[model samples]
Target: MSWKQQPAVVSAPPSEDAVRIRTRSGIAAVLFLPALFIAKVLLLATDKGGRCFVDDIACAPFPDTAFGALLVAVVLALVAAMAAPVRVARGALRAQLLLEAAGVLVVLAYP
Candidate 1:
C-alpha cells in the first residue's frame, strides 16, 4: 500500500487508574522485596533448631546461600523495574511480585 493510502494511527492516552496502578506497582517493587527479605531473615534467625554451634553472640541461624542470592536478585530486579520505561515498569513489577509471592509460598510450605 502507498503511504498516502494508509490510515493514520490513533492511540488513547493512558487512564488515571492505569497510571496509578503503574505508579503503585513501581513503588511496591521498590519496597516489598526488602520487606520480604527481612521477614525471611527473621524467620530463619529465630528458628531454634538452626542455631550456631560457635559464639552465640555473633551467630544466628543462617539461611541457605541460594536464598541469599535470591534476595540479592530480587533487589536487582526492583532496581531494574524502577529504571524501566513507564509502559514496561508495570509488567516488570507484576512479574517481580509474582516471583516474590511464589518464593514466599515455598518458604512457608517447606517442612
Candidate 2:
C-alpha cells in the first residue's frame, strides 16, 4: 500500500461494553416516548372485558432488542393489571418478546 493510502490508522469495532451501552441507550429512547411509555395503562384501561390484544395496538418499532423490552414490559404491566382472568395473547407475540429479551440480555452480558 502506498504511504499516503495507508497514512491513517484503521478503526476497530466498538468494544462490547460500548455496543451494549448504545443498545441500552436506544432502548431507553423507545421507553422515553410518551405514548409508548404509557401504553400499558392505556391499553388496560381501554380494554373492554379483557378482549384487547397486543395487535389492537400497532406493535410499532417492529421486532428488535430495544423495542422488545417495551413490548415485554407492556405485556407484563397488562398482565399485572388484569384480574383473575389473564388474557395473555395467544400467538408469536409472547414468544417474540421472550426472544427479544433473551437476545438483548445476551448482548448486554456479552457484547
Separately for all candidates shown, the number of backbone clashes (residues 3 or more apart, or on different chains) is 0, 1
lDDT for model 1 comes to 0.60
Tens digits of per-residue lDDT for model 1, 1-111: 656667888988766656665676667666765766665566556554134322344453345675667666666656656666666766667776776765665454331
lDDT of 2 by residue, 1-111 (tens): 655555777888655544444454345435444434344445445543134344444423325666567556645533332311222322223443455455444333321
What is every candidate's alpha-carbon RMSD to the true fold?
7.5, 18.3
lDDT of 2 at 22: 43
Q: Return the TM-score for each candidate structure.
A: 0.45, 0.28
* lDDT of candidates 1 onward, in order: 0.60, 0.42
